[model samples]
Target chain A: GAGVSQSPRYKVAKRGQDVALRCDPISGHVSLFWYQQALGQGPEFLTYFQNEAQLDKSGLPSDRFFAERPEGSVSTLKIQRTQQEDSAVYLCASSLGASAGGNIQYFGAGTRLSVL
Target chain B: AQTVTQSQPEMSVQEAETVTLSCTYDTSESDYYLFWYKQPPSRQMILVIRQEAYKQQNATENRFSVNFQKAAKSFSLKISDSQLGDAAMYFCAYWGGANSKLTFGKGITLSVRP
Candidate 1:
Protein backbone atom coordinates (compact mmCIF):
# COMPACT_ATOMS: atom_id res chain seq x y z
CA GLY A 1 0.00 0.00 0.00
CA ALA A 2 1.07 3.59 -0.60
CA GLY A 3 0.33 4.63 3.00
CA VAL A 4 2.72 4.63 5.93
CA SER A 5 4.18 1.21 6.75
CA GLN A 6 5.08 0.01 10.25
CA SER A 7 7.11 -3.11 10.79
CA PRO A 8 6.59 -5.91 13.30
CA ARG A 9 2.80 -5.62 13.55
CA TYR A 10 3.18 -7.30 16.94
CA LYS A 11 6.19 -7.59 19.24
CA VAL A 12 6.59 -9.33 22.56
CA ALA A 13 9.59 -8.37 24.66
CA LYS A 14 10.82 -9.46 28.04
CA ARG A 15 11.13 -6.86 30.77
CA GLY A 16 14.38 -4.88 30.60
CA GLN A 17 14.88 -5.86 26.95
CA ASP A 18 15.24 -3.34 24.17
CA VAL A 19 12.95 -3.17 21.13
CA ALA A 20 12.84 -1.10 18.01
CA LEU A 21 9.79 -0.30 15.87
CA ARG A 22 10.19 0.98 12.33
CA CYS A 23 7.97 3.27 10.26
CA ASP A 24 8.22 4.02 6.55
CA PRO A 25 6.35 7.16 5.66
CA ILE A 26 4.69 7.89 2.35
CA SER A 27 6.86 9.09 -0.48
CA GLY A 28 7.44 12.85 -0.59
CA HIS A 29 5.98 13.38 2.84
CA VAL A 30 7.73 16.17 4.71
CA SER A 31 6.50 15.49 8.21
CA LEU A 32 6.24 12.31 10.28
CA PHE A 33 4.81 11.66 13.73
CA TRP A 34 4.77 8.85 16.30
CA TYR A 35 2.07 8.14 18.88
CA GLN A 36 1.50 5.59 21.63
CA GLN A 37 -1.97 4.19 22.28
CA ALA A 38 -2.49 2.10 25.38
CA LEU A 39 -5.29 -0.42 25.72
CA GLY A 40 -8.70 1.24 25.40
CA GLN A 41 -7.08 4.68 25.24
CA GLY A 42 -6.44 7.20 22.54
CA PRO A 43 -3.02 7.66 21.02
CA GLU A 44 -0.69 10.13 22.71
CA PHE A 45 1.95 11.99 20.78
CA LEU A 46 5.45 10.56 21.10
CA THR A 47 7.64 12.47 18.70
CA TYR A 48 7.81 14.25 15.36
CA PHE A 49 10.29 14.60 12.53
CA GLN A 50 10.56 16.95 9.62
CA ASN A 51 12.89 15.97 6.77
CA GLU A 52 15.57 14.27 8.87
CA ALA A 53 15.42 16.78 11.73
CA GLN A 54 13.80 15.63 14.95
CA LEU A 55 11.86 18.78 15.63
CA ASP A 56 10.14 17.67 18.83
CA LYS A 57 10.32 14.71 21.19
CA SER A 58 8.78 16.08 24.39
CA GLY A 59 5.96 13.55 24.24
CA LEU A 60 8.39 10.71 24.92
CA PRO A 61 7.62 9.39 28.38
CA SER A 62 11.18 8.82 29.52
CA ASP A 63 14.77 8.48 28.51
CA ARG A 64 14.02 4.81 27.87
CA PHE A 65 11.84 5.96 24.96
CA PHE A 66 13.86 7.28 22.04
CA ALA A 67 12.93 7.92 18.41
CA GLU A 68 14.94 8.95 15.39
CA ARG A 69 14.39 9.68 11.72
CA PRO A 70 17.91 9.99 10.38
CA GLU A 71 16.83 9.78 6.77
CA GLY A 72 13.51 11.64 7.13
CA SER A 73 11.80 8.93 5.08
CA VAL A 74 12.02 6.21 7.73
CA SER A 75 11.66 6.51 11.52
CA THR A 76 12.42 4.24 14.42
CA LEU A 77 11.05 4.26 17.97
CA LYS A 78 13.38 2.42 20.32
CA ILE A 79 12.55 1.69 23.92
CA GLN A 80 15.34 0.59 26.21
CA ARG A 81 14.89 -1.34 29.43
CA THR A 82 11.27 -1.90 28.65
CA GLN A 83 8.79 -2.14 31.50
CA GLN A 84 5.18 -3.29 31.73
CA GLU A 85 4.20 0.34 31.24
CA ASP A 86 5.95 0.33 27.86
CA SER A 87 3.40 -1.99 26.36
CA ALA A 88 1.17 -0.22 23.84
CA VAL A 89 0.40 0.23 20.15
CA TYR A 90 2.83 2.61 18.47
CA LEU A 91 1.40 4.44 15.46
CA CYS A 92 3.20 6.35 12.70
CA ALA A 93 1.66 9.10 10.62
CA SER A 94 2.88 11.29 7.78
CA SER A 95 1.71 14.45 6.11
CA LEU A 96 2.52 16.15 2.82
CA GLY A 97 3.21 19.70 3.97
CA ALA A 98 3.56 21.94 7.00
CA SER A 99 0.45 24.06 6.56
CA ALA A 100 -2.68 23.69 8.67
CA GLY A 101 -4.93 21.54 6.49
CA GLY A 102 -1.85 20.19 4.77
CA ASN A 103 -0.90 18.61 8.05
CA ILE A 104 -3.76 16.16 7.93
CA GLN A 105 -1.99 12.94 8.76
CA TYR A 106 -2.39 9.50 7.24
CA PHE A 107 -1.66 6.69 9.66
CA GLY A 108 -0.29 3.16 9.34
CA ALA A 109 -1.41 -0.01 11.00
CA GLY A 110 0.42 0.41 14.31
CA THR A 111 2.91 -1.94 15.94
CA ARG A 112 1.50 -3.48 19.07
CA LEU A 113 4.24 -4.17 21.63
CA SER A 114 3.65 -6.30 24.69
CA VAL A 115 6.19 -6.19 27.50
CA LEU A 116 5.94 -9.26 29.68
CA ALA B 1 -2.51 22.59 26.77
CA GLN B 2 -5.47 21.52 24.66
CA THR B 3 -7.62 18.65 25.78
CA VAL B 4 -10.36 16.65 24.05
CA THR B 5 -13.14 14.88 25.91
CA GLN B 6 -15.31 11.99 24.80
CA SER B 7 -17.43 11.23 27.83
CA GLN B 8 -19.23 8.26 26.32
CA PRO B 9 -17.21 5.11 26.55
CA GLU B 10 -19.38 3.10 24.13
CA MET B 11 -22.47 3.43 21.98
CA SER B 12 -24.57 1.21 19.70
CA VAL B 13 -26.80 2.02 16.79
CA GLN B 14 -28.94 0.00 14.43
CA GLU B 15 -27.92 -0.33 10.84
CA ALA B 16 -29.49 2.25 8.52
CA GLU B 17 -30.32 4.40 11.56
CA THR B 18 -28.71 7.60 12.72
CA VAL B 19 -26.38 8.07 15.65
CA THR B 20 -24.48 10.86 17.31
CA LEU B 21 -21.19 10.72 19.21
CA SER B 22 -20.40 13.60 21.49
CA CYS B 23 -17.06 15.34 21.97
CA THR B 24 -15.94 18.47 23.82
CA TYR B 25 -12.60 20.23 24.00
CA ASP B 26 -10.74 22.77 26.11
CA THR B 27 -8.39 25.18 24.44
CA SER B 28 -7.27 28.76 24.99
CA GLU B 29 -6.31 29.27 21.38
CA SER B 30 -8.96 30.56 19.03
CA ASP B 31 -7.39 29.23 15.88
CA TYR B 32 -7.25 25.48 15.67
CA TYR B 33 -8.69 22.41 13.99
CA LEU B 34 -10.93 19.56 15.12
CA PHE B 35 -10.95 16.09 13.64
CA TRP B 36 -12.62 12.72 13.97
CA TYR B 37 -10.58 9.56 13.48
CA LYS B 38 -11.80 5.97 13.36
CA GLN B 39 -9.74 2.98 14.38
CA PRO B 40 -11.01 -0.45 13.54
CA PRO B 41 -9.63 -3.70 14.93
CA SER B 42 -6.89 -3.36 12.36
CA ARG B 43 -5.46 -0.45 14.43
CA GLN B 44 -5.34 1.88 11.49
CA MET B 45 -6.33 5.45 12.36
CA ILE B 46 -8.44 6.69 9.47
CA LEU B 47 -9.35 10.36 9.19
CA VAL B 48 -13.14 10.59 9.00
CA ILE B 49 -13.77 14.33 8.88
CA ARG B 50 -12.38 17.71 9.88
CA GLN B 51 -13.62 21.16 10.81
CA GLU B 52 -11.68 24.39 10.96
CA ALA B 53 -12.46 26.71 13.82
CA TYR B 54 -12.44 29.74 11.63
CA LYS B 55 -15.20 28.36 9.47
CA GLN B 56 -18.60 29.04 10.95
CA GLN B 57 -20.33 26.43 8.83
CA ASN B 58 -20.32 22.85 9.97
CA ALA B 59 -18.30 20.28 8.08
CA THR B 60 -19.84 17.28 6.38
CA GLU B 61 -18.44 14.39 4.43
CA ASN B 62 -20.83 12.03 2.72
CA ARG B 63 -22.89 10.28 5.41
CA PHE B 64 -20.82 11.85 8.19
CA SER B 65 -21.39 15.35 9.50
CA VAL B 66 -20.34 17.43 12.48
CA ASN B 67 -22.18 19.94 14.62
CA PHE B 68 -19.29 22.19 15.51
CA GLN B 69 -20.33 24.67 18.19
CA LYS B 70 -17.28 26.79 18.67
CA ALA B 71 -18.86 28.90 21.35
CA ALA B 72 -19.73 25.91 23.52
CA LYS B 73 -16.48 24.13 22.73
CA SER B 74 -18.49 21.17 21.46
CA PHE B 75 -17.96 19.09 18.36
CA SER B 76 -20.19 16.11 17.83
CA LEU B 77 -20.27 13.64 14.96
CA LYS B 78 -23.48 12.42 13.36
CA ILE B 79 -23.60 9.30 11.22
CA SER B 80 -26.61 8.84 8.97
CA ASP B 81 -27.55 5.48 7.53
CA SER B 82 -25.01 3.77 9.73
CA GLN B 83 -23.43 0.53 8.53
CA LEU B 84 -21.67 -2.35 10.19
CA GLY B 85 -18.38 -1.02 8.91
CA ASP B 86 -18.83 1.95 11.20
CA ALA B 87 -18.18 -0.25 14.21
CA ALA B 88 -14.90 0.96 15.59
CA MET B 89 -13.22 3.23 18.12
CA TYR B 90 -13.76 6.86 17.33
CA PHE B 91 -11.41 9.57 18.62
CA CYS B 92 -11.83 13.29 18.72
CA ALA B 93 -8.65 15.30 18.25
CA TYR B 94 -7.56 18.89 18.45
CA TRP B 95 -4.67 20.44 16.56
CA GLY B 96 -3.32 23.89 17.39
CA GLY B 97 -1.30 24.09 14.15
CA ALA B 98 1.64 25.60 15.99
CA ASN B 99 2.71 22.16 17.07
CA SER B 100 2.61 19.33 14.58
CA LYS B 101 0.91 17.05 17.09
CA LEU B 102 -2.67 16.10 17.85
CA THR B 103 -4.23 16.00 21.31
CA PHE B 104 -6.73 13.17 21.30
CA GLY B 105 -9.53 12.24 23.66
CA LYS B 106 -10.07 8.82 25.11
CA GLY B 107 -11.98 7.19 22.29
CA ILE B 108 -15.53 5.88 22.27
CA THR B 109 -16.26 2.42 20.89
CA LEU B 110 -19.18 2.47 18.45
CA SER B 111 -21.08 -0.64 17.46
CA VAL B 112 -23.44 -0.89 14.51
CA ARG B 113 -26.05 -3.52 15.06
CA PRO B 114 -27.18 -5.40 11.97
Candidate 2:
Protein backbone atom coordinates (compact mmCIF):
# COMPACT_ATOMS: atom_id res chain seq x y z
CA GLY A 1 0.00 0.00 0.00
CA ALA A 2 1.04 3.59 -0.53
CA GLY A 3 0.45 4.34 3.14
CA VAL A 4 -0.53 2.59 6.33
CA SER A 5 -4.06 1.20 6.06
CA GLN A 6 -6.55 0.26 8.77
CA SER A 7 -9.76 -1.66 8.34
CA PRO A 8 -13.24 -0.80 9.59
CA ARG A 9 -12.69 2.95 9.92
CA TYR A 10 -15.47 2.91 12.52
CA LYS A 11 -16.55 0.19 14.86
CA VAL A 12 -19.48 0.03 17.23
CA ALA A 13 -19.27 -2.87 19.58
CA LYS A 14 -21.38 -3.90 22.50
CA ARG A 15 -19.80 -4.44 25.86
CA GLY A 16 -18.37 -7.91 26.32
CA GLN A 17 -18.25 -8.41 22.54
CA ASP A 18 -14.98 -9.28 20.84
CA VAL A 19 -13.61 -6.91 18.24
CA ALA A 20 -10.73 -7.32 15.87
CA LEU A 21 -9.03 -4.38 14.15
CA ARG A 22 -6.63 -4.85 11.28
CA CYS A 23 -3.69 -2.84 9.99
CA ASP A 24 -1.96 -3.13 6.61
CA PRO A 25 1.39 -1.48 6.65
CA ILE A 26 3.38 -0.09 3.78
CA SER A 27 5.05 -2.67 1.67
CA GLY A 28 8.20 -4.08 3.25
CA HIS A 29 7.85 -1.90 6.30
CA VAL A 30 10.00 -3.39 9.05
CA SER A 31 8.39 -1.68 11.97
CA LEU A 32 4.74 -1.45 12.98
CA PHE A 33 3.04 0.12 15.96
CA TRP A 34 -0.38 0.33 17.53
CA TYR A 35 -1.77 3.27 19.48
CA GLN A 36 -5.01 4.11 21.25
CA GLN A 37 -6.37 7.65 21.24
CA ALA A 38 -9.10 8.54 23.66
CA LEU A 39 -11.51 11.34 22.91
CA GLY A 40 -9.75 14.71 23.20
CA GLN A 41 -6.39 13.02 23.77
CA GLY A 42 -3.28 12.16 21.81
CA PRO A 43 -2.37 8.73 20.72
CA GLU A 44 -0.76 6.47 23.32
CA PHE A 45 1.59 3.67 22.43
CA LEU A 46 0.21 0.19 22.87
CA THR A 47 2.74 -2.14 21.25
CA TYR A 48 5.54 -2.28 18.72
CA PHE A 49 6.82 -4.90 16.31
CA GLN A 50 10.06 -5.32 14.47
CA ASN A 51 9.30 -7.71 11.71
CA GLU A 52 7.32 -10.60 13.17
CA ALA A 53 8.92 -10.17 16.55
CA GLN A 54 7.02 -8.34 19.26
CA LEU A 55 9.75 -6.26 20.83
CA ASP A 56 7.55 -4.37 23.26
CA LYS A 57 4.16 -5.10 24.77
CA SER A 58 4.60 -3.20 27.98
CA GLY A 59 2.17 -0.51 26.96
CA LEU A 60 -0.80 -2.79 26.36
CA PRO A 61 -3.52 -1.61 28.74
CA SER A 62 -4.80 -5.00 29.84
CA ASP A 63 -4.94 -8.70 29.14
CA ARG A 64 -8.04 -8.11 27.09
CA PHE A 65 -6.04 -6.12 24.56
CA PHE A 66 -3.81 -8.19 22.28
CA ALA A 67 -1.93 -7.52 19.03
CA GLU A 68 0.06 -9.68 16.69
CA ARG A 69 2.01 -9.43 13.46
CA PRO A 70 2.61 -13.02 12.67
CA GLU A 71 4.01 -12.57 9.16
CA GLY A 72 5.24 -9.01 9.58
CA SER A 73 3.35 -7.83 6.50
CA VAL A 74 0.04 -7.25 8.31
CA SER A 75 -1.14 -6.95 11.88
CA THR A 76 -4.23 -7.32 13.98
CA LEU A 77 -5.38 -5.85 17.30
CA LYS A 78 -8.02 -7.83 19.11
CA ILE A 79 -10.01 -6.70 22.07
CA GLN A 80 -11.91 -9.29 24.03
CA ARG A 81 -14.90 -8.42 26.18
CA THR A 82 -14.78 -4.78 25.30
CA GLN A 83 -15.78 -2.20 27.89
CA GLN A 84 -17.30 1.23 27.51
CA GLU A 85 -14.01 2.82 28.44
CA ASP A 86 -12.45 1.01 25.50
CA SER A 87 -14.18 3.43 23.18
CA ALA A 88 -11.47 5.33 21.35
CA VAL A 89 -9.56 5.52 18.09
CA TYR A 90 -7.15 2.70 17.38
CA LEU A 91 -4.27 3.90 15.25
CA CYS A 92 -1.68 1.95 13.28
CA ALA A 93 1.66 3.26 12.12
CA SER A 94 4.58 1.88 10.13
CA SER A 95 8.19 2.87 9.63
CA LEU A 96 11.47 1.59 8.43
CA GLY A 97 12.69 -0.56 11.30
CA ALA A 98 16.12 -0.26 12.95
CA SER A 99 17.48 2.45 10.67
CA ALA A 100 18.46 5.98 11.41
CA GLY A 101 16.67 7.14 8.26
CA GLY A 102 13.41 5.53 9.37
CA ASN A 103 12.49 7.76 12.26
CA ILE A 104 9.40 9.23 10.62
CA GLN A 105 6.38 7.05 11.21
CA TYR A 106 3.47 7.08 8.78
CA PHE A 107 0.04 6.71 10.32
CA GLY A 108 -3.24 5.41 8.96
CA ALA A 109 -6.74 6.76 9.29
CA GLY A 110 -7.46 5.09 12.59
CA THR A 111 -10.43 2.92 13.45
CA ARG A 112 -12.79 4.62 15.85
CA LEU A 113 -14.04 1.96 18.25
CA SER A 114 -17.15 2.92 20.16
CA VAL A 115 -18.00 0.38 22.80
CA LEU A 116 -21.51 0.65 24.17
CA ALA B 1 10.14 8.31 32.57
CA GLN B 2 9.56 10.72 29.69
CA THR B 3 6.47 12.93 29.64
CA VAL B 4 5.25 15.46 27.10
CA THR B 5 2.86 18.25 28.00
CA GLN B 6 0.72 20.54 25.85
CA SER B 7 -0.94 23.07 28.10
CA GLN B 8 -3.11 24.71 25.47
CA PRO B 9 -6.21 22.75 24.63
CA GLU B 10 -7.20 25.07 21.82
CA MET B 11 -5.81 27.95 19.76
CA SER B 12 -6.98 30.11 16.89
CA VAL B 13 -5.01 31.96 14.25
CA GLN B 14 -5.97 34.25 11.43
CA GLU B 15 -5.20 32.99 7.97
CA ALA B 16 -1.83 34.04 6.60
CA GLU B 17 -0.76 34.95 10.10
CA THR B 18 1.75 33.11 12.21
CA VAL B 19 1.06 31.14 15.37
CA THR B 20 3.03 29.05 17.78
CA LEU B 21 1.91 26.03 19.73
CA SER B 22 3.55 25.42 23.09
CA CYS B 23 5.00 22.12 24.26
CA THR B 24 7.14 21.02 27.16
CA TYR B 25 8.56 17.65 28.01
CA ASP B 26 10.71 16.09 30.73
CA THR B 27 13.15 13.39 29.84
CA SER B 28 16.23 12.05 31.61
CA GLU B 29 17.75 10.76 28.41
CA SER B 30 20.48 12.98 27.01
CA ASP B 31 19.72 12.14 23.43
CA TYR B 32 16.25 11.61 22.02
CA TYR B 33 13.87 12.85 19.33
CA LEU B 34 11.01 15.33 19.35
CA PHE B 35 8.25 15.50 16.78
CA TRP B 36 5.13 17.41 15.82
CA TYR B 37 2.28 15.64 14.12
CA LYS B 38 -0.92 16.99 12.65
CA GLN B 39 -4.19 15.17 12.71
CA PRO B 40 -6.97 16.58 10.58
CA PRO B 41 -10.65 15.75 10.85
CA SER B 42 -9.96 12.75 8.64
CA ARG B 43 -7.98 11.31 11.56
CA GLN B 44 -4.80 10.52 9.69
CA MET B 45 -1.77 11.61 11.66
CA ILE B 46 0.94 13.22 9.59
CA LEU B 47 4.41 14.26 10.61
CA VAL B 48 4.88 18.01 10.42
CA ILE B 49 8.48 18.32 11.59
CA ARG B 50 11.02 16.80 13.93
CA GLN B 51 14.10 17.75 15.92
CA GLU B 52 16.91 15.65 17.22
CA ALA B 53 18.07 16.27 20.75
CA TYR B 54 21.70 16.60 19.78
CA LYS B 55 20.98 19.18 17.11
CA GLN B 56 21.60 22.68 18.37
CA GLN B 57 19.83 24.12 15.35
CA ASN B 58 16.07 24.22 15.21
CA ALA B 59 14.23 22.15 12.64
CA THR B 60 12.13 23.73 9.93
CA GLU B 61 9.95 22.55 7.08
CA ASN B 62 8.54 25.07 4.64
CA ARG B 63 5.98 27.01 6.73
CA PHE B 64 6.34 24.75 9.74
CA SER B 65 9.32 25.09 12.09
CA VAL B 66 10.17 24.21 15.62
CA ASN B 67 11.75 26.26 18.36
CA PHE B 68 13.53 23.52 20.21
CA GLN B 69 15.03 24.44 23.55
CA LYS B 70 16.97 21.51 24.80
CA ALA B 71 17.86 23.10 28.10
CA ALA B 72 14.38 24.35 28.79
CA LYS B 73 12.84 21.10 27.64
CA SER B 74 10.51 23.15 25.46
CA PHE B 75 9.60 22.38 21.87
CA SER B 76 7.10 24.72 20.24
CA LEU B 77 5.77 24.57 16.71
CA LYS B 78 5.51 27.78 14.73
CA ILE B 79 3.41 27.83 11.59
CA SER B 80 4.05 30.79 9.38
CA ASP B 81 1.26 31.98 7.09
CA SER B 82 -1.25 29.72 8.64
CA GLN B 83 -3.91 28.45 6.27
CA LEU B 84 -7.45 27.30 6.85
CA GLY B 85 -6.35 23.82 5.87
CA ASP B 86 -3.98 23.94 8.79
CA ALA B 87 -6.88 23.57 11.17
CA ALA B 88 -6.37 20.37 13.08
CA MET B 89 -5.03 18.83 16.26
CA TYR B 90 -1.32 19.27 16.78
CA PHE B 91 0.54 16.80 18.93
CA CYS B 92 3.96 17.00 20.54
CA ALA B 93 5.74 13.72 20.89
CA TYR B 94 9.02 12.40 22.30
CA TRP B 95 11.03 9.32 21.54
CA GLY B 96 13.73 8.06 23.89
CA GLY B 97 16.07 6.66 21.24
CA ALA B 98 16.19 5.24 17.75
CA ASN B 99 13.33 2.83 17.13
CA SER B 100 11.81 3.73 20.47
CA LYS B 101 8.09 4.12 21.02
CA LEU B 102 6.59 7.60 21.03
CA THR B 103 5.19 9.39 24.08
CA PHE B 104 2.66 12.04 23.13
CA GLY B 105 1.07 14.96 24.88
CA LYS B 106 -2.62 15.69 25.21
CA GLY B 107 -2.56 17.72 21.97
CA ILE B 108 -3.91 21.14 21.02
CA THR B 109 -6.71 21.89 18.59
CA LEU B 110 -5.66 24.55 16.10
CA SER B 111 -8.36 26.60 14.44
CA VAL B 112 -7.32 28.73 11.48
CA ARG B 113 -9.65 31.59 10.77
CA PRO B 114 -9.95 33.12 7.37
TM-score of each: 0.98, 0.97
Residue pairs clashing in model 2 are none
In Å, what is the interface RMSD of model 1?
1.5
lDDT per residue for candidate 1 within A50-77, as digits (tens), equals: 8889888889999999898887688999
Q: What's the residue-level lDDT of B47 in candidate 1?
A: 98
The sequence of per-residue lDDT tens digits that candidate 2 reaches over residues B12-45 is 9999999999999998888888999999999999
Least accurate 10 contiguous residues by lDDT in model 2 chain A = A96-105
Return the lDDT, model 2, position A105: 89
Candidate 1 colliding pairs: none
Docking quality (DockQ) of candidate 2: 0.65
Candidate closest to the true structure, highest DockQ: 1
DockQ of 1: 0.73
State the lDDT of candidate 1 residue by residue for B15-83, as single tens digits. Answer: 999999999999999899999999999999999999999999999999999999999999999999999
Q: lDDT tens string, model 2, A1-116?
A: 89999999999999999999999999988989999999999999899998999988888999999999999889999999999999999999999764233368899999999998
